[model samples]
Target: MASTTAFIDVPESPDRIWQLIGGFGSLPDWLPYIPESELSEGGRVRRLTNQDGGVIVERLQAFDHTARSYSYAIEQAPFPVTGYLSTLSVHPVPGQTAAARVEWSGSFTPVGVSDADAEELFHGIYTDGLAALLKTAQGWRG
Candidate 1:
């Protein structure tokens, strides 16, 4: 399986960051490429529409507010991937009262694409997502 992980430091409390991104259907709020999101299955499923008109459906596998983390599996996506599982987590930095680290990681098998290309695609997506989250967190702080 190809895997990708990305991290970003945000000037916000871990709890605050979790409050911003913890919801299963909150991608459209911080993910720049996501234009909108809809939740169903009693908030266990999320459908995200991207800026390029691509749609991805994901199912929440796990969530822990106290742990500040969540995991999801992709049910449908535009990418050439299968068995995709991803986790997003927030951790408060030690000794940093108002700083936190956010991580997004995913593992999947490439379907019709090269493994390297698939890894690159996911890495780019995570990088863009983390950057957007950091920017928004900064704006909230400002």
Candidate 2:
């Protein structure tokens, strides 16, 4: 399996960051590429609509609200990977009461692609997503 992890430190508390992104179906709230999300299967599955109108279906695999972390697996998507499992988490930055670290990590088997290429793709996605999240959080009043 191939894996990639991307993280960003934002000027926000861990609790605030978690409140923004801890939900299983909250991608649209922080990730601009995902403009819409629909939850099904009693909120265990999420159908996301990308900016290009592509549909991506994912199932929540695990969640730990106390830890401010959640994991999900892709059920259907246009990416050239399978068995995709990803986790998003918020962590407190030691000695930084107004700062937090947000991590996006994933592992998957490449399909019709090299492992390097797959990693690059996901790393870019995670990087861009975190940047957007930072922007959104910066604009948030609470």
For all predicted structures, in order, the TM-scores are: 0.96, 0.97
RMSD to the hidden true structure, all candidates = 1.0, 1.2
> Which candidate has the highest TM-score of all?
2
**Model 1, poorest ten-residue lDDT window?**
133-142
- How far residue 116's Cα lies from its native spot in candidate 1, in Å, is 1.6
Model 2 misplaced stretches (Cα beyond 4 Å) = none
Candidate 1 ranges with C-alpha deviation above 4 Å: none
> In model 2, which range of ten residues has the least summed lDDT?
133-142
In terms of lDDT, model 2 sits at 0.95
